[model samples]
Target: MNIIGGIFGIIFGYVLIRYRERIGGMLGDPAWAASIGGIYNVLIIVGIFIFLWSLTTMTGTSDFLFSPIINLFGGNTPPAPSDF
Candidate 1:
């Protein structure tokens, strides 16, 4: 399941990077077009992040990259038992 999800994520990220201009134009948002770096640039950055994350996940190395973030949000803590 993780491998499948990672593959799809990589493809999705590639699509976002490759067709960012078309996707942004289809959305037809003026703000998207008028941004400082442009919507395509934003999409490219997001796509790169997604691509790297998916690649790491596929290789089972995502833990190294994301452990700090997970720990920051307390994701590694065990759940408390119910009082009832």
Candidate 2:
């Protein structure tokens, strides 16, 4: 599967490079480029926010996503104090 995928990728890349000028002329527009860039920036900012939020609100022993217990098993919420 990997070999087939690699061969296909090489062929696809070759075709893309061969027709890069034509493809660029067809696809390139200042307004389109600007819109795509704006969207990409927005997604990046949103991703950063999500990462920070996950870090902050995490209840497990480890602050970051992956740690010994957390990675091996799953999120371990801290146990409540015994009233007895």
- Residues 1-84 of candidate 2 have per-residue lDDT tens digits of 544544554455555555555655665545645666643443444445444444444433234644665756755667789999
Residue 66 accuracy (lDDT) in model 1: 91
lDDT of 1 at 31: 75
Candidate 1: C-alpha RMSD after superposition: 2.3
Q: What is the TM-score of each candidate against the true structure?
A: 0.77, 0.34
What lDDT would each prediction earn against the true structure?
Answer: 0.88, 0.51
Best by TM-score: 1
Identify the runs in model 1 with alpha carbons over 4 angstroms from their true place.
29-36, 81-84
Candidate 2 segments whose C-alpha is farther than 4 A from its true place: 31-84
Clashes of each: 0, 0
**Model 1, CA-based lDDT:** 0.88
